[model samples]
Target: MAHLLEGNFGQGSGFNECLSEHVLLTRFGIGINDPKWISIRLSLFKSITLPGVVSQNTSKLGWFIFIDSSWPSEFISDILLATKDFEFIKIIKVNFYFEYYIISEKLIAKSIDFYGRCLVSKIDDDDGISLDCFDVLYDLRGDFFACVFSSGYEFLCQNRIFKPSNMPFLTMNTHFDMRSLDDLKYLRIGHHRVAEFIDKERRNLHVQDEGRFWVYSRHKYSDSRFSAVRKSIVDDKKSRVISSADYHHFSIDFSLLQEFRSQSALLNGVPNEKTWLRQADLNEEAEKIYRQLVSMKRVIDEVGADVIQ
Candidate 1:
C-alpha cells in the first residue's frame, strides 16, 4: 500500500506548516570497493536494505541513499530495477573511488538542508528498520539534538559466521537535528564517527531502549566502531559471534547470497550476511512488489506541493 506516487513531495499545510514539519534524513551508503565486492553488496541490498524503508507505516518524508559510482553496470542496473517505483528514494552518487569519511560527510551534508530544522537518521544499506521506524523516530525526536535507538537484532557477523544477538542488544540507532551538523568535530567525519562526538551533543538527546526499531547487521563493512579498539565498543559488544548456531530471528537468506558469491568472484574478503532480505529470493508474490518499486527517473522527480499522505 505504501508504493511511491507521482507528484510534488510537499505537505499541503501551507509554507509555514511544511517548514515546521520535522524532516528526516535516512543515510544509507554502500562503501566503494572492487567490482565483485560491490556486486555482492548489491545483491544483499536488494534483500536486506531497501524493503524496511519503502514499506514504512507513516507519512512520507525525506530519505537519501548514497552509493559509489565505481560500482559495476549490472549492479547499478539492478539498483535502478528495484527502486524504480519509489520516487522519494534519492540516490546521491560519489563519483570516484573511495574516501571513507569524505564520502560519508558529503552524503550526510548534501542530503540535508542545514538551514532547515531537520532530523537525520542513518541506516546502512545492509541494515533495516521495522515498518513504523520513521513514525516512531519522528514522534520521539522532538527538540532533540541527538538520539540513539535500541536495535532488536544484531546479527553478529565475524569470520563468515552468524550468531544472533537478540536480547541485551546494541543501542545503534542514531539521529540528530540539522543544527547539530554544524559542529566541526563530527560534520566532516565518517557516518559512524558521530558516536564519538555524540556525547558532547546529548543534552536534548532521546534514548529509546524498550523495543527493536531496526535490525543492525553487524559486519566488517558496517559503519560503526571505526574509532574503537576492535569495533567492540559499539553497545559494548566484547566478543565475536557467540557460539554460532543456526538461529533465525531477522529476515535473512543465506543460500542466495552464498550462491551469488560462489558464482561470482567475491569470496576473498567480505563475509556472508545471512539475514531476511525478502527481495533476494523472489517468488511470484515477492517479484510483484519488487517490480512495483519505482524507477531512477521517478526517484529524481520532486514532490512540490501536497504532502505525501
Candidate 2:
C-alpha cells in the first residue's frame, strides 16, 4: 500500500490528469510544499498511518510513501527520521511529471518477481486500518479479485467523536491473479469505481459490521466539502467518544493526534488570505460538475443505457 503526500502523480498523462493536479493545488491554497501543510501531514502520517502498519499482525507487507521531489531538505529529513525505524516503509521521491500507475505496475512486478503473486492495497494518509488487515489479505492471496473491508468509522476531530459508518468501497486491494502486468484491464482503478469497472464475480466486498476495522479521520485539512457534510451528518447521529480501546485496536498514538490538532491550530490563518478565496471558485466548479452529472442521469433515466451508449 502507498500514501501520497503531495506526490506529483498523473502529470505525464492526459488533460484529465492536469485538471486533477490543478484542482488539488487550488484546494490547498498554500502550495503543496508549504511548511505548515507538510508538517501537519507528516505528523499525521507518523502518529496515525505508520502506527497502524507497524502494529500489523504480520511484518511482510511493504508501505511505500510518495512525496514531491522538490520538498526542502529539512522536510525530507523529518520524514526519513520518522520512517527510519521501520525497514518495510520506503520513501519514494517523484518529479513533477511522474505517472501514478507506474508505481502500481512497479509494485506488482516486485511482488511477482519475489513471490510470483500480487495483492496491492492503499490507505489514505490520515486513515488507519485494523491490525489484522494484512493477515486477512494474505489468507486470500490466491484469489483473483478486488477486496474491501467496507465497514468503518468516521472520526471527527473537533469533538473527538466516532460515528459508525460504511465508507464507499475504500480501503481496497486488487488481486490480479496473474503473474504478469500485460493486458491488465483492471489495474488499480479508483477505489470508489472498482465495483463499477470490475464484474461482480471478481469483486469481494467483506462487510465487517461487528468490529469496525478501519478509521477514517475528518479534520480541517482534508477536503472541506466532504468533511463538512460528514460533520453535519455526525452532529445529529448518536456518536461514541473515542477511547483507548479504539486507539489500541488501530495501534495509533492518542497523544500524536492531540499534537496534530495543536499544530494545525497554530498554522490556521497563516496562509495568504487571498488563497482562501479559491474555496469560492472550487465551490462554483463543484456545482457545475454536479449539475452536469444530474443532467446526465436525467438523460439516462429518460433514454435508457443502451440509447445513451
Candidate 3:
C-alpha cells in the first residue's frame, strides 16, 4: 500500500513529527517576526511532489526519487521517510532560491558533482534601486566553481535583480560579467549548457532600460576575461581542487565586501572605473556585506559548539 502526507507537518511528537527539529525550534523559539527565516527552513521541503508506486508481494521494494534541483541531506531524509514505500518515484521539478549550500550538500553527498561556471552580472532594473546580485565564480586556484550569492536579498546596486517575495537573495560568484542576452546565449551554446535556462524572452520584456544597457556592456566586459581565467585554471598543474566543504567555509570567510571585492578583482579582474565608482557611491553595500559575513560565522560557531557538546 502507498500513503502520502503533506502540509506544515505541525509542531508535536509522534506522527505529527514530520518536520525537522531545527524548524520546530526556530518556529516556536524565534517566533514569526521574520518571514524569511520561516521560508529558509520550510520552503525547501514543502514543494516536494512525489508519486508513489507499489506492487503486491514486494516487501523488498526500493524506490528512486528524482528531484529537479538538489536538496539538502536532512530534507531528503525527511522526504524519503515522509513518502515511504514507492517502487518507482519521480520528483517532477523543483525551484531553489538563495540556498546553494543546501543544494551543494545534497549533490556532493550523492556524488553528482556539477559546477555552474562562467557567469556574469548585469543590471535588471533601475529606480536608483539596489538589488542583490548572483553569479557563478570560478576559483582558479581551486579549479572549482563556488556559487555565492548575497547573504540577504538587500538592494545595493541600482540595476540588479530584486529578491522575489518567495525567494532568498542568494547570488553566485564569478569573475565574468554577464550583462547581455548575447553573453548568456554564448554560454548556453557552449559545453557548459545545462537544462536550466533563464527564459530571456520573458526577462527582456520586463527588465528596465538602463538594466538592459548594462547587461549588454557586462557581456562585453566578461567574455575575454572568462576565457583567460578558464584556461589558466585548467592548464595550471598547481591549481587547488576545492571541495564542497571548503566552498562552504570560503563563503563564510569571503562574505565581507573587503574580502569579496579584493578576491573578486584578483580572480576575475579589476572592476572598471564605472563599476568601482558606482559601488563607492553605495556606502551601505560594504556594511551589509560585513554584517552578513558576521552572521554566517556566528551560525558556524554555534553549529560547531553544538557538535562538541
Candidate 4:
C-alpha cells in the first residue's frame, strides 16, 4: 500500500557531502487546532516519541520541533515546559498561514550553508525513532539527497493497551535534507516517502531495508489516511507485547507511559485495579479514561482546565 504512493513526488539532487550534523526536523501537530489531536500528541510525546530521541546513542544530531503559533497558549506552554528539559530541541511556532511543507523546505534552504554536511529527517510527533536511527542513517547516507528507511515497528497504542506489531515495513525514517520534504508530497504518515517531491525530474532514491529503524504508532487521533481508526493492522494474531530486544536503541520504558495513563485515569476518577488492570472486568477501564481525555480535550481552548481542577 505504501508503494502505491511511491514515485509520486519530486526527487532531489544526490548531493551527499560528509555531514557535520544530522538534524531531526519534526512537526509536532503544527497547524492542527483540533483539541483531540493536541491531547493525543501530548500524551504520545510524553511517553513514546521524545524519550527515544533524548536516549540516542549518537549525539551528532539536533532535534528541530515545529508547532503552530495559533495553538492554545496553554497547549504550547506545556510543550515548551517539557522541552526545557531537553536542550537540543529547538521549538519553532509557524504562522497561521504556514503548513508543514513550507516549514520543512524553508528550513532546508536556510540550512544549506550552516553545516558542512546536513542530514535532515522528519519524525512524527506521535511516532519514535530508534536510538541508533541517526547512527545508521548517517553512516549509510553517502551523497544521496535522501534515504527512506524501509523498516520499523508498529506500536498499537490505543485504549491503554501497548501492542507491538510482529512485522517490518510498518515505519520508515527519511532524512538528509529531509525535514523540508514534509512540504513535498503531503499528510503525516505518508509524508516520509519524500522521494517524489525533490526538485529533480528523475529522482535517485536510495532505498535501504534497515529493519527496526523507527517505530510508528496508532491511536484514536492519528492524522493520516487512517484518521482515528485502525487501518494498518497487517495481522491481528501476530500482535504481542514489545520485548526488550524490540528496539535498537532502548527498550520502551513503560514506566513513562504508565505515568501518563495513570494521570489521565485519575483525572477521570477511574478506579484503581484490584489485582491488575488487565483483569477481564477492569480491563480497558483506564484505557477509556485516557481515551476520554483525548475526546474531552478536543475543545480544550474553550473548555479551560477547571473540569480537571
Candidate number achieving the greatest TM-score relative to the actual structure: 2
TM-scores of all candidate predictions against the true structure:
0.56, 0.70, 0.16, 0.63
Give residue 88's lDDT in candidate 4 (0 to 100).
59
RMSD in Å for model 1: 13.3
lDDT of each: 0.47, 0.58, 0.25, 0.54
Instruction: Say which candidate scores most in lDDT.
Output: 2
- lDDT score at residue 122, model 2, on the 0-100 scale: 63
Give the TM-score (vs. native) of candidate 1: 0.56
Tens digits of per-residue lDDT, candidate 4, 16-63, equal: 221235667666664456665576578778677877787775366556
- Cα lDDT tens digits, model 3, 1-309, are 223211111112321211110000000101112232222222212211111012111222222222313344454455456445452222212222112123222222222112222232211111111111211122122332212222322211111122211111111111122332344342223222221233333221111112110111111122345444445444555434433332232221212223323333434342233321222323346445645876887987988856655
Prediction 4 global C-alpha lDDT: 0.54
Which stretches in model 3 have alpha-carbon errors above 4 Å? Answer: 1-49, 52-82, 86-97, 109-309
Give the Å error, residue 110, model 1.
Answer: 8.6
User: Which has the better TM-score: candidate 1, or candidate 4?
Assistant: 4
In candidate 3, how many Å is residue 214 off? 38
lDDT of 2 by residue, 1-309 (tens): 222333333222322211110000101112255666677777777777778877875455556665657678888887777777765555656542122344545555556566655555666667777787666656655554555666777777645788877765764322234355652445545556667766654454443344467877766665546445455657755678888888888787888888887887675433333322433554457546656876999999999999999
| Candidates by TM-score, descending order | 2, 4, 1, 3
Q: Which stretches of candidate 1 lie over 4 Å from their true place?
A: 1-33, 96-115, 156-172, 180-196, 218-309
